[model samples]
Target: MVRARVLRGVDLDVPAGRLTAVVGRPEAGKTTLLNCVGGLERPDRGTVHIGADRITGLGDSALTRLRRDRIGFVFATCSLFPTLSVEQNIRIGAELAGRRTEKQWFTTVVELLGLSLLLRTRPSALTAEQRQRVACARAFLNRPDLVLADEPAGELDRMEAAALLGFLRMWVRKLGQSVLLATRDPFVAAHADRVFVLAQGRITGEVERPTVESVMAAM
Candidate 1:
């Protein structure tokens, strides 16, 4: 059997209350890195820390608890339950964690994401952008310590993608949330406070306060 190593010596920090991005082409180990950090996949070696707790060697149950209480995720696909209304979908995160949803925060997230009018609608009824907003709102509703977004705006059109990125930026700046977004798009990378360029399973370069041109150059 051949063992493939996807990420090699990738060390980076996601500061609190900021948006950090990893930009890379397809098969550059971007998704693998996120999975390891999020505790969905355990690395062969290395450490992952969330706040003061080291999660690298934790057991499955411990990792589950950590994820439930501290981490949020936004994937390329807006993975909402088709049977549930948007409001139900958003609330389900809290429900699964056995936590009560704070009414004020819930309302705030809904309004900020422009989903107030669509709460009662099911995921299938939404446009691509609207469904993604619902996903964003659900991820932020808990105010998790860290949010991992993997190609979150990958399927949206230019205008929709920009709007989605703007909302992500607003949450980080105004609400003191931390986000680590992984994408192949330079435009998406530009929205981050700092960008890490990945290639062939390694971080090749970094650009602080990245512009689209700067990120493209780094790539």
Candidate 2:
């Protein structure tokens, strides 16, 4: 594997079932940290373990399979196949995991995201917020080991952003899955259970139960 040499003597253990905010300024290496955690990038000096499995040493095929089966992503831009309906778009996650969609999981996701009625609609027919909501539903549908979101709400309006954050909080509380979200937004970072502020490729500070006031002062 081509290990990504980013974490130099850096150490952080994310507790299960919590929303972890990786926050820092531009080029602060927040995205790189998320990539490493999600196995999109391997750590050169340290191993990444998801439970008992050492992810950093996995072969390409093994890593690919691990990512497909155990992780989900929400990029800064909403990545979806516009030609596919909302249902089919969401289906792609489970399909990649090589698991037939669980009916209960799919139904719960659609209802939680209010996408059941829009399942037949195309991506172009929806607003940006709607499109992102579909993406969220898809990511959660598979019950992944970890969810990595890079600026997932960066494009939304204030109200939409708040709603998105609340939705993520609910996921953490209800689904019991860990989420690693990287963003530059102070308000968004405020919602996390723990906030790690990176600077010059190192974690400069940390705030437990992050808030806009606390995180801003750290930055």
Candidate 3:
């Protein structure tokens, strides 16, 4: 038995300790591309490799395990357990992956995201920005090799979006982790170390040290 690939001949590389942005208009297959990279959707052609593992060839169970252990994902929507305290929610990823949270790293991430004071609060009690930060914490708490974020700042205001992007970039550099962020906003793409422009299901161009103008031009 075989499964058909969902994507065409798309090639991408997210370098370690760098934040790469995939920018495109809505319905331009940005989510689909991100999903394939995260192993949520398999491409019909090409391969997706995270670190040393070629994830595209793995079976469902293996892919699931690999994603759980080596990758983290943050989406546009807030994903949180309303009844769970922030600390409990943040630790869920490590627990599910059969790993323990490293105290120092956890502390560092919490402080970096300004989540220390909100540790005891539930998701329902937090502001939109705070909840999103908590989601970021959960994604990074396990210290995964790579993180895939799909429009993570879509719900935020301009200032909050800028802050979130800054936080994401800082953490990627500090932890030497790779990140693939998908977005339609040039403002958001400008925060990336490099940006790839996608259009009509294909990569149209690449921009280095992207600015809003550069990213828009690339698109």
CA-lDDT, candidates in order = 0.92, 0.84, 0.87
Candidate 1 residue-wise lDDT at 171: 95
> Residues 116-164, candidate 1, lDDT per residue (tens digit)?
9999998998998888888889889888999999899999988999999
lDDT of 2 by residue, 86-164 (tens): 9999989677667798788789889988888999999999988888888888788888888888998889988998888
Worst 10 residues of 2 by lDDT: 3-12
The TM-scores of all predictions, comma-separated, are 0.98, 0.93, 0.93
lDDT of 3: 0.87
- Cα lDDT tens digits, model 3, 28-128, are 88999988888888777778888777888889999888778778888887688887899999998787777777789889989999999989988898887
How large an RMSD does model 3 have?
2.5
**Which sections of candidate 2 miss by over 4 Å?**
1-7
Colliding pairs, model 2: none
Candidate 1: minimum summed lDDT over ten consecutive residues — where?
Answer: 69-78
Question: Of the candidates numbered 2 and 3, which has the greater lDDT value?
Answer: 3
